[model samples]
Target: MIDSTISSFPLIGLVLLLGLAIGSFLNVVIHRIPRGESVVRPGSRCPACGHRVRPGDNIPVIGYLRLRGRCRDCGAAISRRYPLVEMLTGIIFVAIAIKSGLTIDAALEAIFASAMIALIFTDAREQLLPDVITCPLLLFTLLAAAWRGGWGEPVAYPFDLSLVFATESETGFPAMRAAIVGGLLIAAAVPSFWLIDRLDIFLFNKYHDWQTETDSTRQLTAEEETAIASYEHQDRRMKRLAMAIAIVSSLLWVTLALRLGNHDPLAWKGAWSGLTGAVTGALVGALPLWWLRTGYYLVRGVEGLGLGDVKLMAGIGAFLGWQGALCILLISSIAGSLVGLWMMRTSTARLATAIPFGCFLGSAALAMLLKQIIWLAA
Candidate 1:
């Protein structure tokens, strides 16, 4: 009889080894995914020697130690991030095995959390947030959350907590509902800002760039644009690339979300929890900008709602349901805004610059959801 016991020494060891190996791959994704580059086409290679990493040199944490953090051919340095990520994955995988005892929900949550960690790390490093991570996160999480019955004070099979978490006036439903209202508010806010900016540009061509007119703005003719492109160099090109990536990711995510929203079994029954959570994240992430703009008109800077954040939240909604999403919204807002301000004040970040709010939101949301489940069980 193949007794299903994962805590057994052999099985536990295998899970750790598997996790560490996957984590090593995840590091590749974190590094290349943001650049919209392939993680698979080109196998691992030393940055200095351009030598494809040999199988012996590819064992997660052990390989790094064996190689002494240097490429065999070029003797170049390797990053600590690689080992850190690998170790993190190994530990988390073991923890999941213990918590879930080989359940489907445990398997799913563990992977989702790992994916988010990758996204968070990448976004933090390159300021590159992708909808790819967020979209899947939302859908999988919603199903996982419901199936696990992690919802607060569960009464009904689907979800109910208006009583346990109830305030003097507000109920669980409303708090859950707040995420929805907040998300819609955010969606409405960003387009309005874009509309106003467009109006300003049209009304006063003098306000060419609208935010800050550059030499490019002054160069209107095609002949002048070519000159400007040549003179402007990499800045324009990088912005264009960033924009292209953002657009592609957003379109792919929204298309998937709309389909799920229409056809997912849960969507047909009650409140679309994941959708709500995503919207809640959107609203919470966008709130400061929306508030700042109501008075000054230029609060959200150029990249309103950050394309990454939008898809990320929408993806969150798809995963965590409305209530868990609300938790994500509050947590992400408090955390992101604080970090944003710190980066602005301490770092070279300019005022009103667009940052990856979704990265923070996604991470915090995931952390909180995990915490709630554990605490409730305890």
Candidate 2:
């Protein structure tokens, strides 16, 4: 193991502090973004009373503890989630640093982990994954992959971007090329899936109408009847438009890459090969959910997987590569299934209740990343 040259506890402490600060900002994001409010323009305010949080009272976990977990002005009880998010981020940051040892990979992991935390809570609370976060995350991860070369092979100790640029052999083609490939693949894949979703919905509607006509045993409520009668896929045109854009973008990229040719013998020719793996991983991560969603709809005549989940998995593939995405699916499925079954038995949640699946995916992916770090340390 490379000596990080700092005492572990102190370093962890410092990072924990940073994480708490970042987590405080994340609390605002989770609250505001889903509601389509600006996360920046409006400072933290009491939800109950609309009193802007005083700076002294806004100190992450400490503020909550000092105030006895209530608003300083209004004295309304605050949710425990504020402190929990801060503490969870702190712990995740510490774990990543311990596993990665002050490396760039650790820093990148910390950022991604923070975003994942925000996504988890936002989805859990609202069942919405804001594109504001997920879209940027996807783009950033592709760049990170380019900068770090491929997954599994992070730049070594004495981390330097100059060296990253100087040593082309390490990164495969340049960072620019890898970014192009990763971006292109993501673009093409996401829209294709969107089109598939539109088609699936159309078919589901047709199937439902057929069943309604033929089967007398199934009784439809007034609300259900109205919903089916009014149901038209609202975003069909949007999906078609997106698919066209993606197709053009993908073809342009392939043409550009092919034109670039083999200029440098020392350049790692495997950049394309690496991207192929990423594309495969992304597809592997997304397709299973699509199959499950479509299959569930056929059986139950209700939408199971939201489009948010499909997009989230695609982003996961771009960031973690495909294998990590598969691991996320496995872990999340087990966790969600267990929780879902428990909810069915113990709560008002029925089999048809739409659980926030994106929450599970985000949480599971972050967990697997942490586990990866722990396994590396072990």
Candidate 3:
């Protein structure tokens, strides 16, 4: 018989290499996905020169280094972000491979992580965390978790994933459990963070808006107030408009997923958990921020929820189901709070801050999903 061990080595190496290559492509997706642009179609081009990048010129980390982090056609300097994205993706890919071998879930996990990197950094640069990546992430995380299988019919040992992988040939329930648990964790986490923040805010300034005292957004200057009159009674309408985004997106995902899985209501419990976590998280993260936004508008042009975030959470809920999504929500909140505090304490002596809770929410959701995989054996 062909040597199973020898054959496996080549396969593993090939997967790792392909993952690195894919990581390079993910860099482009990261930049463009948030803009609502097609990941395919346009192909690669230099932002400065508008010159198409040839196959040879697109060689991942090597390409950036050889070109000295600049576009060869335009000779314009490129930000180090490109190389960093490639490297980060490569590392995450390799790590996931080590964790789960060449399973579909592993591949999806890598993609999920890559998407988060894009979402987190993009939001950091511009105050936006697009539904594009987050939506896909939640859907795939749930589907991948639910529609999963394994390698062999070997043994099932306690607290050992290797054995679980071998024995867990069937799909459905186990993955469902993982997704449910993870999403629930995220759901529980976010409100807990908000509760704590609420407590802190209530303790310090009970009547003041939770975020304004801490918001970094500058006060309206005399000229800006004049501009506000032009917008008029639109803020309330905008909030209502934002509601449509969440409603439509959630329905679409739920329908799409049900059609694909052909599952029953009970079968949906696990998948639904991811969605629950996302919605819960979105509310927890956005409520205070929304209050801040509305507060600024003085009852105009302000919303209780950023339609984008609300819709995005619905997508998250669809993918993660309920439980696992919750974990993501919670973990993200903790991270964001810590980071915002550090930034605030070090950078400015402001009384209030406008922390980007979406950044934390996204990250926590991803974390919760990942933990589900690791804890599956348990």
C-alpha lDDT score of every prediction, in listed order: 0.55, 0.67, 0.51
What's the TM-score of every candidate structure?
0.59, 0.73, 0.55
Comparing 1 and 2 on TM-score, the stronger one? 2
Across 1-378, the per-residue lDDT of candidate 1 in tens digits comes to 111456589888988998898899899888766545557869987766779998998999999999999888788899998999899788777766765566665577677768777877877676656444544444444344333433221112233332222243421233333233323432332333335446545643432331123334453777645543543343344344544544454444344434443444333222333333334433443444434433343543333444355445544543454555566777877886897788789977575545566577756755653663356457
Q: Identify the runs in model 3 with alpha carbons over 4 angstroms from their true place.
A: 1-9, 34-36, 136-142, 145-307, 311-321, 349-354, 370-378
C-alpha-based local distance difference test score of model 1:
0.55
What does candidate 2 score on TM?
0.73
lDDT for model 2 comes to 0.67
User: Lowest lDDT 10-mer window, candidate 1?
Assistant: 149-158
lDDT of 3 by residue, 1-378 (tens): 111232365666676667667767777766665444456769888878889987777888788888888888888997787878777666556556656566655666676677666766666555555544444443443334333322221111122222232223334433443443443433343233335336534643443332232343878666545433332223333333443443454455444444544454334433433333334434443454445544654555333333344434544443444444445556655776688779787976653434555566566655554553346435
Best-fitting candidate, scored by lDDT: 2
Give lDDT: candidate 3, residue 76: 92
lDDT of 2 by residue, 159-192 (tens): 2222323446543455355446544664655355
